[model samples]
Target: MNFKTKLLAYHAIAAAIAVIPMQSMASDVEIKYEKFPLTSPEAQQIWAAESNDATPLGEEKPWAMIAKVKVPGKKDLVVSQLFSSMHCGGIECPIKIMQEGLVISEGMACDAYEYHELSDDHEALMACDAIIPLDLK
Candidate 1:
């Protein structure tokens, strides 16, 4: 083959090799968890059931505090605390960590939470402050 022809063929082969990885990486899909607002009926129903009530109590139903959370290398989660209900009062409200309409963790007390910078690719779920472990085991 001529010098120019060989050079052109080498470049073409290198370009094809580079494109392979990019194509494979593009095919990798990450499933994101669905988000629900605090006032949404879906969120309210979940909390109500967790609180052992058929429906939320008081005029202000869905009194739970909800926060969208994302941890590193983890699926998105919704953290909720029923701050006002017959089963709970004051800072003793129960904490629930949920994802995809399923409760991952619950029955922990949370006075509040510390949210990190979610906009800058930081972990959205930081720490649940003032949490007292209910299970002694």
Candidate 2:
């Protein structure tokens, strides 16, 4: 190829490489605590413990699944929250909802706390099509 054509080809390849990563990143969803306005005292406490240096925030365990249930014409969306245990003990280790940043739901075992009452039932949990284990540490 002539110099101009060769230069144009190199530019096209470079542009493609740059565009590909951005597209991949756009498709990827990252769950972070800050995304949801979880400001309750219990949530705050959990957040603090997670940040502490001495806390034993172990590797994320596969706790729950998220499924994109089909609803006509609307965007394909998955239920945002999934089950996660921080590996802490007692009250600290209760199942948490990682998406939306707040604990929208918890296991029935956490019924002692009023907020945990918002948790989903077994049928709801089973409906999820995808499971992602959370790594709290």
Candidate 3:
């Protein structure tokens, strides 16, 4: 209750705040492509779900996932993709990936994040998904 004690307490609180990480509700997600035969079990599962029919450009690299969908109460849906390579195009590239099947718990990166996802894309979640072209205009 003295000035000195109060100052020390404030400093301790500030230090604790600095060390603690900030948590927020994450909505969007993305990941980049990596070589297949992934080592992690999670990664392997994701890769297995990929479409075999995608084009080289789609299959080769830049795999991604870009879904904002979530099944309330249940965990958020998992998305993965490579739609362009599967030969679908237009606005948004029509990338797809396995969902629910690729289901991930809240608060984690998608498998495609291994590749690189500065922004969200649908490549990591599109395995076995139907390819539908969208209009850009």
The CA lDDT of each predicted structure is: 0.51, 0.33, 0.38
Please say which candidate is ahead in lDDT: 1 or 3.
1
Model 2, CA-based lDDT: 0.33
Q: Which 10-residue window in model 1 sums to the lowest lDDT?
A: 128-137
Say which prediction, candidate 2 or candidate 3, comes out ahead on TM-score: 3
How well is each residue in 14-129 modelled by candidate 3, as lDDT tens digits? 97775452211121443334333223354445554444544455355434344434433333443444333444343233333344464332222223333322112222222212
RMSD of each: 16.2, 14.5, 13.7
Q: Clash pairs of candidate 2?
A: 36-100, 60-134
Model 2 CA lDDT for position 94: 36
Deviation of model 3 at 99, angstroms:
6.0
Q: How far is candidate 1 from the true structure (C-alpha RMSD, Å)?
A: 16.2
TM-scores of the candidates are 0.45, 0.22, 0.29
Please state the error at residue 121 of candidate 2 in Å.
Answer: 28
Residue-level lDDT tens digits of model 2 in 1-137: 89999999999999999767434332122222222222334344334443333232245332222223232332232333222343334443333443334443343232122222111211222211122232221
